[model samples]
Target: MTDSGQFNSELMAFLDASPTPFHAVQSMQQRLQQAGFVRLDESQPWQLQPAGRYFTTRNGSSLIAFVRGTAALPEGGLRLIGAHTDSPCLMIKPHADLYAHGYHQLSVEVYGGALLNPWFDRDLSIAGRIVVSADGQLRSRLIDFKRPMAVIPSLAIHLDREANSDRTINPQNDIKPILLQGGDSSLQAIIAEQFMAADEQLVDYELSLYDCAGATLSGADSQFISSARLDNLLSCFVGLQSLLASDASHTAVLVCNDHEEVGSVSAVGADGPFLQAVLGRICGDQLDSALATSLLLSCDNAHALHPNFPAVHDAAHLPQLNGGPVIKTNVKQRYASNALGAALVKQLAGRCGVPLQSFVARNDMGCGSTIGPISAAKLGVNTLDIGIPQLAMHSARELTGASDPLRLVTLLTAFINSVAPLCVIAD
Candidate 1:
């Protein structure tokens, strides 16, 4: 039996090891590989076997792992947990190298709705995919500037007397991260040097700035996790662990898509055909029927009730840190937790002996949406929005209860492993 402390320890390591989506997928792939799961490629034929464990990756950022079951196809459907590998960060542009006042800075674009204030003066690094030509063939390589290579400094208070009073960030002008002091070195040169590929040429890249400060267990009693990318990476890791532990009666799938933070519309995102294509191959002619009966657990991070701003949350639907997993809801379908889905989760929680929590935004406040509704509408699968409660969701470093992840793992393992159907016919 794995204790909560051990789980948190692993989660912290996962967070520290994964600085970008590319790195995140690599980390998950390594874990699944160690757990006796084989890797499959999309270009090659998949000879799936019953009771077999296999996984696959796309664009090196998105990943899907599944376990074949003993039950019949289509009718048995699938138990899937979907999460995103993306978080709010600054992405380096193509012409990123800029020289200003003898200090070289990297021009970046805001990738998502990042809480920009927290990004200033933080220890930052760069990591993403780089394209290089080798032997007249195009190849992709993942790079990580793991050390404190950059920092987005704030304007001095003396320069702006009202800096603290009305601070508004201009992404174009105010957020250029100073990387080094030089005019001769290009961005490609820096990357090529890191690659140790003096013979290779750097053509293009998709790099993002990241917090190099590692994840830590905070609080006096070490009861909290403080880290970056926790919004979705936490769920990604939890789903991976649960799927690896499950001997699911029906087919179990875990899809961690990229670009969810930026609306999930890319070739490797959840909105694209990556998942549908995989389902088609797995279900054969029964793809439609299998999807109709399939259940999707859209696992993302849920907002926890802030101690300082309790009024921001719905009074009756406040979720607390360390309470347990939260089933997020919205009447506007921002989250796809319908009556059936909510009941199913509650039932699973009961069986797993995990306390269930619910989260609903204040009526006047605009609610944040997840990948749940998009998945349900696109695939026609029954989807439920669920996650661990955490504070400072889109910040550079977020906070969460240490034990919440273990609770989610327990529920999801039982949920996926259960042999019974997700719904009753009401005979």
Candidate 2:
């Protein structure tokens, strides 16, 4: 197989393992550990030496790692790649206990920007981290009640008649997923049995309902991917691969954050101190200098203008599949990139001989933001937001170009390894 073919295979394998945010971070932790990276917890004291590789995790969801450069922490600063792990899905609520209309059901609160309609009538499962009671202490356990377990059956067309033409879903009333028969069991009871924990110890959980079906390669020659949480996981896989591939003279870091889809305010989010804490420990007093010249790349998925919904996107800047990576910008600073950040990425793309695309939302439509703005604000660093154009963003099965992920990795490797500074452009 060719190099691109090889990357495609590797990426699909990575995506298959990461169905939930917890799984995404755990899988990443394992990969980094195998690559000679030592694990460090934030609560413990850190003695990071030059040329060492260290990592830390937050809430078992977000992760940050740093590879010390050949030289001492440079005044020119650190190079960071950031991506989010949590995707839009139905989250099981605290009072998740319910038996609605003769079926055992789990009350779920919608998390992030989910395309709600796609969830209807799909076979679903529950997966995430659970805090279980254990001998007067609580332990966090990762669980995936993996099976064709739950579903939300849509209303029949025969009943509504105009279902296809004009139907609207009320999330509060219509979107709850049916799990099992009445009086069969409680969700907590089932979870305790799955983990072999005491019924009393499985006190609470932060679980999300997910599509139970396997993610597969579709289209002729398997050129397309159909998966449940590709919106951001695709970026996570690309960023981690590029970080591993990078050989930078400056410190190289990759941050996979959780809770971005809902507002990014959690301890594991970009807005929190997770990234800052890692940098402070790595650079210490040099943290200030690092922020002065440091650059962050917020990698996420951008929406490609659908051919059928041409009016919804900016007519002139329609991003397409197989169109290479895109430099996302917003006049309102929704995306943290200015002309300089975007140009810097363009230069890297050119150096790598890779194609590049640009994305701008329709003037009237509200644009989506990434970790770029939050990271920049929190660290006061120079940052750029970039991504691969994708369709069905926030949907159960998001789609992207077959070739774009590797292209992104290539561009990022070039950027991380380059010593050139990002030149600021004046209007």
TM-score of each: 0.97, 0.95
Q: Model 1 clash pairs? A: none
* Alpha-carbon runs more than 4 Å astray in model 1: none
lDDT of 1 by residue, 257-372 (tens): 99898898888888888998888878788878777677899999899999899889888999999999999989999999987888888988998899989998888998788888
After superposition on all C-alphas, the RMSD of every candidate to the true structure, in Å, is 1.4, 2.0
| Superposed Cα deviation of residue 315, candidate 2 (Å) | 1.9
Model 2 per-residue lDDT tens digits across residues 189-240: 7887777544447767888888877766677766666677777988888888
RMSD of 2: 2.0
**Which number leads on TM-score?**
1
Q: Best by lDDT, which number?
A: 1
* TM-score of predicted structure 1: 0.97
